[model samples]
Target: MTSTALTDDMALRIGLAARALPDTSPARLLAVLADCIGLPPNAEKLDTLSIKQLRSGASGELADCDHSVLKTALAYLNGTASTESMPPPVPQSPLINASGSDPEGTIRVAIASNNGDLLDGHFGSCERFLVYQVSADQFRLIDCREIDDRQAEDDKNSYRAGLIADCQLLYVVSIGGPAAAKVVKRDIHPIKIPDGGAAPALIGELQQIIGAKTPPWLAKIMGQPAESRVRFKARALEE
Candidate 1:
């Protein structure tokens, strides 16, 4: 692998490891991490900041982990970071209510989840998928599929992708490069939502867009009706 790739991988590893430790503060984690990697110069008082705060600080403070490491590390910390250390999926919201119907012309989106609620799981690690049908003004919970744990890695990813094959988009906290490729090959767009967002929060944002304008990409695929666009513009001008 290239030097940059190596650093990125290391940063992810460091972030996950740091979050797993108990009673560990971000500042202390950085201090220990620095010492292990010969701790860069010009780094002072970093051990006092939270992982979230540290990412916003200077590159000089990060020493070697600056270039590609800081952002990825912080993403892991913010989205997947926890002292629970690979704990089972805990729902951050209420149980989803799916009607088992997919509305035509709506984008079919899938989210990796441990619970029946949030997009707080990795594509490879999450055992379940929450499927949503998203139109411009509304989104509906349509289906839920759970993977069989007995499958091997090769069997698992592709199989999981197949379960939600009809979906146009997939969301997850993280996904391995290979698994992401597999998802894409099935014609599904994979979206990485940082900070492990709640499913309802994300759905609400999409609904707001439907009420406003259709994004270029979605417009291209779903193709808004000409009359509706004209009507929407007329209303906009009137307002």
Candidate 2:
């Protein structure tokens, strides 16, 4: 097949793979793309697909496709295409479990990205924020906040932080110390995931963390609800 045809066909196959998924939101699809093609986990720069059309598109498994071309395409779109030959893509995760048990506790997160899916946007110029409600059992996308066109550049970062003020954590590829401090001042933790991965992976991993043996940081941010705590106490008394 011609290169163009191959790419289009491959893209179609990938889309089909995506559609096979139970949930095909752009954020979810991009996370799957990152798993399948070695795309870094946040909304950076992928021209082949945009986050705006994520839910409509599909992604599950691009099994038995050309790895070389896939690598080149991902690198090119991500601006990492080099003269040297691309390496083989790392193995991708097949799916993200979107369903959750009961959100033992909820941790709202903001991921910075040029697109809604990749964690590629820097603190200075991200196009939007994809907000998610995360729990050990399941997670769901709750909102997408775009940068205001009328907001001055100087105040935009702070404004963006405000947009996700209810969120507990902010994940970005990079952020300045001052901006991070500003986020912390608002009681939101800013985590710099330089090697951004898919949001589902990140969120799922955190869900596991909270569900299993939680770290101190996670525990602090995820205090049990009063009812749950009360129930636990009642159960302890019964025992």
Candidate 3:
């Protein structure tokens, strides 16, 4: 990756990791990380670093920092932090009061989640999938599919894909190539959220895209009429 891209990606990870360290700002974490791993931090470097290295690097200004928080910070940086260490879950809102009735033009979305109502889970490691039926005007939580430990031990990625087989879209903080292939084979589009956040906000953004001008790929997935697809294509070409 380009230096700018690496720095930007590292910046997002540092921000999340910093949250784990009490009173530690992203800038402070970045400086400490740089001291430990060298300048221009990248994900590959951070993934290889250990808690011991971070503690050893925490000197001068951070010499007196808590070790527990440092370990938590490293876990967050590596995307291995447990749900308990993550930010509190957001409550599910606008959950469907009625079942088996979906609005026209709606698509089912599976959000990889470790904490409540947040798109903070990786495809392989997230605790559950929060399923939502989303349309241009509204969205409602339809189900939450918990991962089965037994299945995880054997062919986990395929098992996970089976859990959300009905969903047209899959949102995850990160997904490995093999896992992504499985999802795609099931006709589910996988969207990676580098900096995960509240599920509602992300779905709202998707709603906007659907309402305004659906992309060609999305249009196809939504099964828009041929004329509608042509119109969308024309509009996109005009831009």
Clashes of each: 2, 19, 0
Off by over 4 Å in 1: 1-101, 223-239
Least accurate stretch of 10 residues (summed lDDT) in model 3? 88-97
Name the better of 2 and 3 by TM-score: 3
Deviating ranges (above 4 Å) for candidate 2: 1-104, 152-154, 224-239
* Tens-digit per-residue lDDT, 1-239, candidate 3: 53533455566677767654434578887778778887677767778887777766747444443454455567778767652434434325433336644545888999987677888667766678999888898888878887774765668789899999988999987677888999999999999876778998999999998875898888888878888889989998999
Output the TM-score of candidate 2. Answer: 0.51
Per-residue CA lDDT of model 2 for 1-239, tens digit only, reads 32312254345444433322222333555555555334443323354543322322334232222232234234533444332222222222222345743244667888875543656455655667777777777777776677663574667557777888878889977676677887888888888776676776787777877664555566576775555555655665676
TM-score, every prediction: 0.52, 0.51, 0.63
* Clash pairs detected, candidate 3: none
**Model 2 lowest lDDT segment of ten:** 85-94
Global Cα lDDT for candidate 1? 0.59
lDDT at 132 for candidate 2?
A: 77
Residue 57 miss distance in model 2 (angstroms)? 41
